[model samples]
Target: MNQQTNSEAKEFGSLLLDVGVYLLSSGASCSRIRITMRRLAIAYNYSPHISIAPKSISLALNDEADNALFSGMRTTPAQGVNFKTISGISRLSWNASENDLSVQQVRDELSRLIALPHYPRLVILLFVSVAGSAFCFTFGGTLLEMIITFGATFCGLFMRQEAIKHKFNPYICVYIGALVASLFAGAFVKAGLNINFEHAFATSVLYLIPGVPLINCFTDLIDGNILNGVVRGINALMFALAIALGLLSAMLIYNLK
Candidate 1:
């Protein structure tokens, strides 16, 4: 009975961490969220992978830039609390039964959510409009293409918003952003609009900063978890590749005309 209860607690703690991750990524309104998980084990108190341990639910919120993923880790020993020896057979629980805190899980969930076609539909449409404006400018339709690009770029700031929402696959987002920018550039060029590709490209690419995961990877290495670090680095690299592919696809389509 006790073992089952502890197991349930760990699962619950994991869930809380997941939610915390989402809030942090969402850039909603947070400065930061502080969290701690407490558990007691019979033989061993913890594992490195679990975000929180049963005995110490008193940990503070860590930052993305800090690389605290595996860095600055310290083991909380089970014994000597209240003068009693602790065991490896652990029992775990949480303070708040309501808030979610599962960071990594939520990252994956957000990816799945954004991957849906509907989310990109409007974003893509706005991009097309910008492209048309550029096409007009190239062909001497109007000088207003510059104004259109400015407005479109401003609204697209939500790209950063999504990043905060824990869209770990930043490369895909960059690709889409590039596709939008390139569409405009190609259109302007094709239409003989007087516009600089460099400006459009620079304006839209700010959405590609995969900052948090990169920090996590660095932190993992600092914490002596090289394997975890390498894995995260690979994921970052793949995201970068996705961005490149998005750009390549857009360019290829542009050249076809």
Candidate 2:
């Protein structure tokens, strides 16, 4: 390859890797990331080869006409779920493919999408807490149980968010959230609240469940990505174990039967 062609290949490979990394970190399934990146590559008149792993993604950009190839791998740690980002990037891929966008234009749009802010912290806390209460109610909890569950869920999630902001280990953060929530609900039980305190205690920590990871795990397996699926499955199990250990600690402290 000539100098200019080689440079162009490198640039494209880097950009494609960035896209794959962002998608993976944002909680897109392995298949989704591969499909999206392939779409983008074909749009730019290049062929793409991709391999996704739990903590990394590898991409290669090939130009058949010139027989030029550029390949690279990028680390893509779990960044937490952001469906908005996934959707935005999917749309961007289609737009790029249809409009034949320049590399710079695609880069600008990707930047804009990544820069978008999430919902307000308080807003998330409120809604998620409410959902916890709803779960309690669905399981035949009384009004008081629901109320206590709401408080426990709110406090727990707030602490989790704080811990995340402080860059604590993610599993440790889950444990902290579960501990705080269960403690709050367990306190009411220890106080002889004369209600179904068990219900509140059981449901308060439900918010800590890693629903997305579990779903993604199954999806990856069904899509024939066994390695990624197993990795995700193990990750989900760890989170569940964290929650269980935290709740168990609370039960031991409160001596709850």
Candidate 3:
């Protein structure tokens, strides 16, 4: 019975990891999946591995699914043994890893997701651009401020629709664009542009900071995975800082003009 339990625990751990990895590859933040999977591991009394790559996880899931579907095998999470259980894992697995592929492949997949019938991430992004701009124009502390910020954000986003079509590295592009785009924002500031460089720069950094990882770190903490959680939090904070510093430098330069 002890051996059986141990075996079961391992299987469930792997399944959970694979599923989580699939989700990460599909665009869910790494921190989100890491936190979620760690909890699942503890709940099932399984030892979980750290930082499984999304691509690797997705491929494993695909292989598992193909073997199960074609060979009449089913996965049973509760038992920790994959049998003909006919559970929802298969569908969930498919949904998670369907888009797992190379960088070029991911870009293609992203384009498809953006063009999907139900939800267009691009449209939402466009909205963010306009809303963000409106807020910069008018202080973001009020609804009116948001309107202006969002408007400018929208303009940046809309104006670059063609750029997105080129299938380039959007994260890097947006980060760089924010520097140039923010100059326009700085110009739009009310009170005759006497905004303090440091404060304005700090506040502007919130627009795209990777807050998800910080939240994910706490989630990991809740699951008692202190080391991994802390690491993820630190990494995320580093990225957030980079973004802030980049914005700050850009703002300082613009202020000199």
RMSD of each: 14.1, 1.2, 11.5
Question: Clash number for every model?
Answer: 39, 0, 19
- TM-score for each candidate, following the candidate numbering: 0.42, 0.97, 0.49
Which parts of model 1 have CA positions greater than 4 angstroms off?
1-174
Candidate 2 segments whose C-alpha is farther than 4 A from its true place: none
Native-structure RMSD, model 2: 1.2
Tens-place lDDT per residue, model 3, 119-154, is 376776665665454445454344444444454455
Q: What is the C-alpha lDDT profile of model 1 across 1-257, one tens digit per residue? A: 25654554454344434433333332211112222222211112232223322222222222223322222223332211110111100111131223342434433543443333333646744664565456445544445545545443444434534543565445555666556655554565567656555444433433444555567567766776576566667766776676566556766887732
lDDT of each: 0.42, 0.91, 0.46
Tens-digit lDDT track of model 2 for 55-157: 8888777786747489899997558899988999999999999988888898999989989999999899999999999999999999999999999999999
TM-score of 3: 0.49
Model number with the top lDDT: 2
Cα displacement (Å) at residue 21, model 3: 1.6
- The stretch of ten residues in a row with the least summed lDDT in candidate 1 is 83-92
